[model samples]
Target: MQQIEFQLEHEFVELNQLLKLVGLCDSGGAGKALVATGEVCVDGTQELRKTAKIRAGQRVRMGDVEIQVGSST
Candidate 1:
């Protein structure tokens, strides 16, 4: 699996934006569409919320990609 580290600049980031920020998709809109396909997972469970609040210390996975969210500080 591919691992990606994302440092949060705020308390949290929207799931779709996070995917975009990490280069998973072209834009947030595309991210939302990807999430709607039920391919995204949060902490090992399927996550369908396109705008779900993703906080630090959380893990997001889609296919072979896994994004590990961390605190900015």
Candidate 2:
């Protein structure tokens, strides 16, 4: 699967929050549901915490879609 990276303007961001920020899920509730079902992965590991604190340089995966946090440039 192709990996896409995101650039955050904050020091830390919630995992579920990131899903919405990146247009992954429609809403926070939906994001939470996705995470709760163990559908989300952090740095290649399944992450069940809806509010997982994620920072730059970390990776996230929802099935085949993988996202990484980093600067655009």
> Best TM-score goes to which candidate?
1
Model 1, global lDDT: 0.98
Query: Candidate 2: TM-score?
Result: 0.90
Which 10 successive residues of model 2 have the least lDDT summed?
Answer: 64-73
- The 0-to-1 C-alpha lDDT of every candidate, in the order given, reads 0.98, 0.88
lDDT score, residue 53, model 2?
92
Alpha carbon deviation, residue 35, candidate 1 (Å)? 0.3
Candidate 1 per-residue lDDT over residues 1-73, each given as its tens digit? 9999999989999999999999999999999999999999999999999999999999999999999999987
Report the Cα lDDT for residue 30, model 1: 99
How many backbone overlaps does candidate 1 show? Answer: 0
